[model samples]
Target: MHVVIVGAGEVGRAIAANLESSHDVVVIDQDGDIVDELTYSLDVLAIEGDGTEIATLQEAGVEEAGLVIACTDDDETNVVVCGAAKTKSDVFTIARVRRRTLLETWEGSQGAFGVDFMVCTDLLTAQTIFRISGLPSAQDVDMFAGGLVRMAEFEITSESPVAGLSVQEADRYDSLTFAGIFRDDEMVVAKGDSVMQAGDRVVVIGSPDSVSGFGDDIVTRTSNGLEEVVIVGASEIGFQAAREFEEHGYRPRLIEQDHDRAREVAEALPNTIVMESDATDTEFLAREHVDEADIVIAALDGDEKNLLVSLLAKRLGVDRTVAIIENLEYAELFETVGIDVAVNPREETAEEIVRFTRADYTEKVAMLEHDRAEVIEIEIGEDSALQGGTIAEATADLPEGVVIGAISRGGDLVTPRGTTVIEPGDHVVVFVDANVLDEVIEAI
Candidate 1:
C-alpha cells in the first residue's frame, strides 16, 4: 500500500513513522526544514510543497496512493487537499478537521469534500479522557466488538492485592487474559510464570464487565464516592468532557475565566454549573469547596497554564487530576510531578489514522507499552485456515508472544481455553508481539 500524508506536524510525523515499516509512505509539507528532518530521521519519502496544489499531489504520488490523509492545521486547507487528491485518482481520503460545524456537515453525507472519513482532535481527546477518568483506574482504555469487548491498562500499586502474585496465581477472573506487563520500562510478554510487581503497568483484554471487575479488584482507590467533578477551563476539551460526564450521569461544575464564554457554555450545557472566575484564585476555589471534588480537569489552551492549574488542584486535595498537554516532553514531566493523567490530542489522532491504514484492516487496534505490542480484533471466515480447529491447535504454529484473548460466537462471549474450538464466523481478539505483526496478519 502507498500512503501520502499532507502536513509535517506532530500528527503527520507520527502517522508516517507508524506506516513506514509496512507500507510505502510519502509526506508532503510546505516547510523544507521539517521535510529534511523527516527524511533524515525516518525511512520515508518527504516532499516540500503546498499540499493543496495539484502539482504537489502529483509529485507525492497521489494517483497511486491507496490512502491520502490531510492533516494540516487549517481546516480549509485540509479539505482542499482531499478534494485535490480526488481529482488525481479515486483514492481513499481522510480529512482531519478541528471545527465541529465543518465536521458535522461533512459527516452527514458521503463524498463531501471528497473525504471518505473525518477525525476530530477535540472529540478524540475528550473521548479518551472520559474513558480513563470514568474507569478511574486504567491508564489507557479502548473498546472493541461494539463496546462488548474491552482492553485496559492498569497500574499495579503497592496496596493492590495482585501486586506480588504471579500471572498464574492471579488467574482469578474467568474471562480475562493478561496480555503483557511493563516493568522498569521493559516489555515482558505475560505467561503463566510471569510475576506481577508494584509500579508495573499491566494490559488485559476481556469482556467489558469482566475488565471493569478486574480493575476494581486491583486498584487501591475505592470508587464509592466519585460523583463530583470540577473542570478548570471552558476550552473545547473541557466542554466536551463535561458533556461526556453528564451523559454518563455525572453533573460537572465548569469554571471559565471569561464571563461571556462561561455564560455561553452554561447556556449550552443545562446540567453543568458555569462559574465565571479565574481557576488560579485559591480563595475562590476554597469558597466553592473544590477540595471535595472527586476529580479536577486542567484543559486550558496553554500547556504551562494547564500544568500550573493541575498542580494547584492537586494541592487543594483533589484525588485525581487530568491535564491536556501539547508537548510530548512536558507530558512526562507533568506525570512525574503529580498529575494523574496527561492527554495528548495529536498523538491520539495519529493513532486512529494508523489504525485505519493497517493491511488487514482489523476490526480495531490498540497500541500498548509505547507501541511495543498491539491488541487486534478480526473475524474468522468459513474457508479460513483457522476455522474448525481447537484454539490450541490453531495457534500452535504461530509466534510464542501472541495470545487469543477472547472469542465471540453468535453474540455469546467465550473465554478461550485449550478445548475451545475456532468456529467459522467467530470474532477472535488477539494480542500480538509488535515484531511479528506481519506474520500475524498473514496467518489471519
Candidate 2:
C-alpha cells in the first residue's frame, strides 16, 4: 500500500515511521529543514511543498495513494489538506483536529469536508485521563473487543501487594493474563517464575471486572478513595476533562488564570467549580485547600508551567499528579522526577491514526510503552493457524513474545488456557511484542 502524509510534525512523523516498515510512505512538509531531516531519519520519501496545493499532491502521486493523512498542528490546515487530496483521488482521508466542536460536526455529517475519518486530540487525551483515573496506579488504560476486554499498564511500588510476588502467585484473578514486565530498559515476557520488582511496570489484559479487581487488590487504598479532583488550567484538554468528571457524577474544581476563559468554562460546566487564579500561587492553593485533593492534573499551555504546577501539587500532599507534556522527550523525565503519569497528546493521536493501517484481520489496536509492544483484537477465521486447535498446540508453530490474553465467543468471556480450544469466529485479543508483530499478524 502507498500512503501519503502531510505536515511532518511529531504526529505525522510517528504515523510515517509506523507505516514505512510495511508500506510505501511519503511525507510532505513546508519547512525545508524538517523535510531534509526526515529524509535521512526515516525510510519514507520526504517532499518539500504545500500539501494543500494541487500541484504538490500531483508531485507526491496522490492519485495512486491508498491513504492520505493530514496531521498538521493547525486544525484548518489539516482539514484543507484532506479536502484537497480528495480532489485528486478517491483515497481514504483522515484529519486530526484539536477542537471537539469540529469532531462533533464531522460526526454528524460523515464524509463532510472530504474526510473519511477524524480524530480529536483534546477529546482523546481527556478520555485517556478519565480512564486512567478510575484505576489505582494505572499508567495507561485502553479498551478493546467492544469493551469486553481491557488492557492496563501499572507500576509496582514498594507499597503494592504484588511488588515481590512471582507471576504464578499473582495469577489468582480469573480471565487475566500477565503479558509482559518492563524492568528499567529491558522488556521481560512474563512467565510462571518471573518475579515482579518494585519499580517494574506490568501490563495485563482480561475482562473488565477482573482487571478492576486486580487493580483494587494490588494498591493500598486510602480512607478516601480517589474522589476529590483538581484540574489546573482552562485549556481545551483541561476543560474537557472537568466535563468528563462532572458527567460521571463528580464535582471537580478547575483553576484558570484568565478571567474571561474561567467565566466561559464556569458557565459551560455548572457542576464544576471554576476559580480564576494562578495555579502557581502557593498562598492561593493553600487557602483553597488544594492540598487535600486526591488527584491534581496540570494542563497549562506550556510544558514548563505544567511541570512546575505538578511538582508543587506533589509537594502540597496531592496523592497523584498528571502532567500534559508536549515534548515527547520530557515524558520520561516528568515521571522519573515524581509525576505519576505524563500524557502526550501527539502520541495519543498518532496511535489512534495508526490503528486504521493494520491488516484487515485486526479489529482494534493499542500501542504500549511508545510502541515497544501492541495489544490487538482479531477475529479467528477458518484457515487461521489458531482455529480448530488448542492454544498450546497452535502456539508451538508461532514465535516467542506472543500471548493469548482473552477470548470472546458469542458475546461471552472465555478465559484462555493451554488446553483451551480456539474455534472459528472467536474474537481473540492477543499481546505481541513489536519485534514479532508482522509475523504474528500474518500467522493469526
Candidate 3:
C-alpha cells in the first residue's frame, strides 16, 4: 500500500520511518532541506511542495495512496490538507492537531473535516503524563485489554531488592512477567537466567494491580502524606493533566506564568488551585512548598523551562517529576538527568497514528522501545483459524519472541497458559518483538 504523508516534521518523519519498511511512503514538505534530508536518510519519496495545495497532492500521487496523513505543525494546514486530499482521492485520511477543540468539534459533528481520524498531540501528551504519574515508579505505562492489563517500564534503583537478582528470582510476583531489560544502551531478552543489573530499565507486563505492585517494589517512594501536586505550567498539556489528576482524586496546584491564563484555568478546573507565578523561580516554588508535592509536572511550552522547573521541583524534595518535552532528543536526556518520566507529544502521537497503518487494523497497537516492538490487541472472529485450537497448538508455529500478555472473553480477563483454549470473540493481547509482527498476525 502507498502512504502519502504531509509535513516532514518530527511526527511525519517518524511515521515515514516506520511505514517505509513495509509500505511505499511519500513525504511532502515545503522546506527542500527537510525533504532532501528525509530522502537521503529514509527509503521514502520526498517532495518539496505545499501540502494543502491540490497540485502538491497530485504531485505526491494522493489518488494512488491507500492512506494520507496530514501531520504538519499547523493544525489548520493539516485539516485543510486532509480535506483537499479527499477531493483527489478516496484514501483514508488522518489529521494531526495540537488543539483538543478541533478533535472535539470533528468528533461531535461526525467528521466535519472529511477526516477519517484526528490525533491530538496535547491530549496524548496529557494522557501519557497522567499514566506515568499514577505509577510513579514506572518510566512509561500503557494499558491493553480494556483496563485489565498493563505494560510498564521502570528503572531498577540501586536500593531495589531485586536489582541484582536473576529473572527467575525477580519473577516472584504473580500474574506479572518480566519482558526485557535495557542496560548500557542495549536491549537484552529477559530469559530465566538473565540477571537484572542496577540502572537497568526493565519492562513488565501483567494485570494493573500486579504491575503497580511490582513498580512499588522497585522504586522507593511514599505517596501517603504528599497530597499536594505541583504543576509548573498552565499550557494546554498542563491544564489537561490537572483535570485528569483531579478526576483521579488528586489535589493539583497549577502554577501559571500568565495571570489571565491562570484565571481561565482556575475557572475551568474548579478542583484545582491556579496560582500565577514563574515556574522557574526557585523562590516562588519554595513559597508554594513544592517540596511536599507527591508529583510535580513540568509542562511549560519551552523545553528548557520545563527542564529547569523539573530540576527545581526535585531539588525542593518533590518525590517525582514528569516533564512534557517536544524535542525527541531531549526526552531521553530528561530521564537520564533524573526527571522521573518524560512525555513527548510528537512521539506519542506518532506511535498512536502508526497503528492505523497496519494491515489487520487491530483494536489497538502500542509502540514500544522506540518502535522496535509492538503490543497488539485483536478480536478473534468466529470463523477465524485460531478459534478451536489450544494456546499451545495455535502458537506452536509462531516465533518465540511473541508473548500472549492477556486474554479477554465475555468481559472476563484471563492470564493464559498452554492449556487455555482460544475462543471466538476472545480479545488476545500479544507483545511482539523485532520484525515478527507481520508473521505473528499471519499465523493467527
| TM-scores, one per candidate | 0.95, 0.97, 0.94
The most accurate candidate by TM-score is 2
lDDT of the candidates, in the order given: 0.86, 0.92, 0.85
Residue 147 in model 2: lDDT: 91
Per-residue CA lDDT of model 3 for 73-160, tens digit only, reads 9999999998999999899999999999999999899768989999998988888888887775777788887887788888888899
Clashing pairs in 3: none
Q: Is candidate 1 or candidate 3 better by lDDT?
A: 1
Worst 10 residues of 3 by lDDT: 219-228
TM-score of 1: 0.95
Superior by TM-score: candidate 1 or candidate 3: 1
lDDT of 1 by residue, 1-444 (tens): 899999989899988887888889999999999999999999899999999999999999999999999998888999999999999899999999877778789978867999999998888888888888766567789987777788898888888899899999998897898888888668888888999998888888898888888888886563474788998899988888888888888889999999889988999898999899999999999999998888888989899999999999989888789899888778778877978888888888888887888636587888775567888888988765567888778888787778888887888788888788888788888888888887887777
**Model 2 weakest lDDT span, ten residues long:** 217-226
Pairs of colliding residues, candidate 2: none
Best by lDDT: 2
Q: What stretches of model 2 exceed 4 Å from their correct place? A: none
lDDT tens per residue, model 2, 57-148? 88998999999999999999999999999998999999999999999999999899999999999998999999998888889999987899
